[model samples]
Target: MHAAVGLALISLLILLLLPFAHHAVLFGAEGLGIGTLRDTYLIAVDAPFGNLAISGHMLAGAVVTLLAPLQLIPWLRMRHPGWHRWSGRVITLLGLVTGAAGLVHILSRGTIGGWVMDLGFGLYGLLLMLACVQTLRTARAGRMRDHRAWALRTFWLAIGSWLYRVHYGLWYLATDGLASNPDFSGTFDLMQNFAFYLPYLLIVELWLRLQRRGV
Candidate 1:
């Protein structure tokens, strides 16, 4: 029953992520001159480094979004421990790549919403990289309990890009785009810049606390 539930959730997550991943891959390719679907705003013709950084972030983020959830399936970890270990390594590596590239882009080109968005996203990237490092460090030290806690944090951050879009989509559908603008400097936009990952991370921290308390 647990396996079934896990599979169902993972499947749903993949389904929701399919389009986002596809777009990321395509956009990344285009930014790198592998394709012609370029958006000048995202991939400036004059800024190769910034383009590369953002493109790499998107591509790695797409893969992380797809793979992170599989790492959580209890049956997969119990039955195929080797798979878990190797996949964890890939996820951590890509998570760092995603975070680093994002930071690079933000620092180089900045976000459309100006310094506020840059600050919010910059912090998000820093936290993501930190989680990835902590996850790997704990695992390497054979600290399984600490490893699991960091791994859960890593998973949430791995899919945060997707969650950011999901939050905007729901908000637009409910309010017809209140407190949002193309520049992404509106009140809701400002809140959303940090909301997608911070709240989730906070919840994970709470859950970890409960586990520690035997609650």
Candidate 2:
């Protein structure tokens, strides 16, 4: 039953992530000048540092989002420990890069929604970096229990960008753009700045606590 559920989740995750990853790849390419920068909102000619930072963040985030689900496969980890370790290393590094680059972009260019968005996104980046660092540190110390918890946190954070889009897509479908503006300063948009990741992280925390209690 657990295996079946895991497979279902992994499948669903991959399905949701496909288009998001594709979009990230294209956006990253355009930001780096491999293609035309049609969206000056993200990639501007005048802000080279911000462009580079956000571009790198998108590219690294794409890989992290796609690779993260595979890392959760118990059989693969059991049978191919080397692959697990190497992939975990890659995920950790890319996660750090993703988080740092995002922070850099926020500091350099700032988000369209102003200080509220900046504060929320800045906190998200910091938490992502923290999760990545703790995952690596706990693993290095041979603390599998703590390592697993942190890894789960890292996984959720790694896919946060895609989740952000998914939330908006679902919201728009349900509400017909209710309380949502182009500048993203509306009530719903303001809530969404932190909603995509924080609630998921809260759920992870609850799950971790339940596991510790053997409930």
Candidate 3:
């Protein structure tokens, strides 16, 4: 059941991000600031460094999302260990780069929730970097079990970007669209800041504990 849910979420994220990846490849950062999201991308475009960070975040995010699901499939690891290791290394490096770039975006541009949102996402990026480092360290140490646990934690946090959008889409539908809906903007902003990432960390902690107990 958990595996099925994970696959569904991964597929959903891939579907959502694939277009952005193509747009980025074909048109680059200039292509992103359009439609309802034009303002956000415009803000990033205003500053040279902001453009770099956001572009790096977008591309690296797409790369990690593409590689992440494959890492979780047991058969791939068993049958093609070499590919798994190489891909894992690439994912780890890209994940760290993207996390740092995300934090840069949050701190430099700010967000709808202000400091609260910045702090929430800032910490999420911090946690992701820590998990990525620990996963790599454990892998180098030949501690496969610990490495796998950290890798899963890293994967969960890495997908927070996609999960946030999913949760926001559901909320948008519940409120019959966010168009001219200023009342719920604050609430939704706050929720999106923490909803997907924090709970996921807690759940992974519990899963690790249960696994240790042979559950």
Candidate 4:
């Protein structure tokens, strides 16, 4: 019970913190503007299209934030009949819209953040699209369990947005002084996406294996 409660509190904290993290541009390249939200990130009405795109991303982030966590809900637990099927349907549809928008927007990001960012987002987007197809194909054949299983795969990919912030935050906290570690900073920045999700995927695979073993 204590563990569950702790996890729930952490999740709540994450939900509360999510919006600020999503507006990462507000915080600048290194995520600097911590307590400075709306005003600090405010755009003059002069840049309407740029404003629209950023707003779209924040909206997309909101959708992803709300939907990604649903996979962990108790009702959609492995044993909950029909729950997985229904949730998987919702996830796949949203995943398509969100993932496609993400890919297109990356081209506009052409920053010093480099190809790794593009690569990471692109790979994640493709994996999600493929995972959705995998789930849909299975669902069409009435293989409901297969649909649930693969939907979890796609769901993890969708959560990469949050996962990126998780990694970026930890990196900043660890490095402390970016100037002293130029080579290290660049290297870490390039590898951030890979580091963020590699272990996550490994753990997910382990969990799925345990689930298969009926634990």
Candidate 5:
């Protein structure tokens, strides 16, 4: 619950910053901070494809920011299974489409951190899609508990858009973060990235374990 609240609070902060798009994290020449929040990238996301990609990205953020959090409430979940499933479908679809668009934006940046950034968000997209499928599989298998578990996993990945911003902010405040280089702050080293998925997966593991223990 603490983590979930963290996710929500962080998401809210991101939401506060979202209206400004990519400008929010401006730092060193290295892209000192995180996030591909640029309106320029989002505007033309997939140029030949019209604005579909950009529109989807914005819309996806809206759904996650505005609606997905409410579903986290226990009573809300129980009271609105139908709404939950419908919203879950929206999240799954939005995560894929926007994530893909985000990947394109990330790749076009052509910086070292740009590459890492692209991969991070691209992997996130694939993981989100996989989580959605796993969620459906668990549901089909009639494993309600597993469904619940995977739901949390999928939700976290979806909420990752929010987590990334908050993580970067705390990292900034803690490290006397770069003021001139995005690349410096959002740097790329394989070992450092161990902190990324390990903590993420560990959170999932701990959450599932606690659910099992009925904690």
Candidate 6:
């Protein structure tokens, strides 16, 4: 059942990532699909560094998203230890770059929900960097178990944007599209910024504790 749930979650994430990857990464680069992207890369025309930062964020995010699920698979890890190590190194690098680029974008452009959202994402980016560094540190120290725990933490935070969309989509549907309602949008935006990554970190910590106990 646990394996089934994990596979299901991964499948859903892949589904969610596909269109964005296609439109934003592939088509948007060629100046083809800006209309489909909500934020639109054309806005990047005015801020060159901001454009570079977001492009790096999206590119690194794609790499991290693709590699993270593979890292979580026990069979792959056991069967190909070398692949795990090398891929993990790449994932760590990409995750750090992704987080840093995101921070750059937020600092340069400022996020919605004012300073509250900025604070939330700022902490999220900081934690992502710390978790990724700890992942590398633990692995280098020959602490495989601790490394895995930190890697899982890093992966969870790396995909926080996807989780935010998932949560927001469900909530929007449940509230009968309250995201479209001007008055309620601010509350939802704030919730997505803070509740998304922070609660996920707590859940990942709880899972790590349970795993350590062989639960």
Worst 10 residues of 5 by lDDT: 24-33
Q: Write the per-residue lDDT of candidate 3 for residues 1-215, one digit (tens) a residue.
A: 58677667667766776664565443334434433334343244456677677777777877776677678866568789998899988888988888898888887876556787788888888887888789888999999999989988988887777777678778777885543244335666666678879999899899999999999
TM-score of 2: 0.96
CA displacement after TM-score superposition, residue 138 of candidate 4 (Å): 3.1
Report, for every candidate in turn, its global Cα lDDT versus the true structure: 0.90, 0.90, 0.75, 0.61, 0.57, 0.74
Candidate 6 segments exceeding 4 Å error:
1-16, 27-42, 179-185, 211-215
Error of 1 at 170 (Å): 0.4
Is 1 or 3 the stronger prediction by lDDT? 1
TM-score for each predicted model, relative to the true structure: 0.96, 0.96, 0.81, 0.66, 0.66, 0.82
Error (Å) of candidate 1 at residue 144 is 0.8
Segments of candidate 3 deviating more than 4 angstroms: 1-28, 31-46, 177-185
Residue pairs in steric clash, candidate 3? none
Reference-based TM-score, model 1? 0.96
RMSD after Cα superposition, model 3: 3.9
> Which of 4 and 6 is the better model by TM-score?
6
Q: For candidate 1, write residues 1-215 as lDDT tens digits.
A: 58798789888988998999998998898888896865468888887888889989988988888888888889889999999899988888998899999999988888988998998899999998899889889999999999999999998988888999999999999999999999998999999889989999999999999999999
Q: Candidate 2: minimum summed lDDT over ten consecutive residues — where? A: 35-44
Model 4 lDDT per residue over 51-103, tens place: 44444554555555555566556534557747656766766775675566566
Q: Write candidate 5's Cα lDDT for 65-122 as tens digits.
A: 4454555666556778888778767766765666665555455443245455556556
| Residue 162 Cα positional deviation in candidate 4, in Å, after optimal superposition | 1.0
* Candidate 2 per-residue lDDT over residues 19-111, each given as its tens digit: 999998999989988977774688888777778999999999899898888888888888999988989888889988998999998998899
Q: Which digits, one per residue and each the tens of the lDDT, describe model 6 over residues 120-154?
A: 88888888888888998999999988888898788
Better of 3 and 5 by TM-score: 3
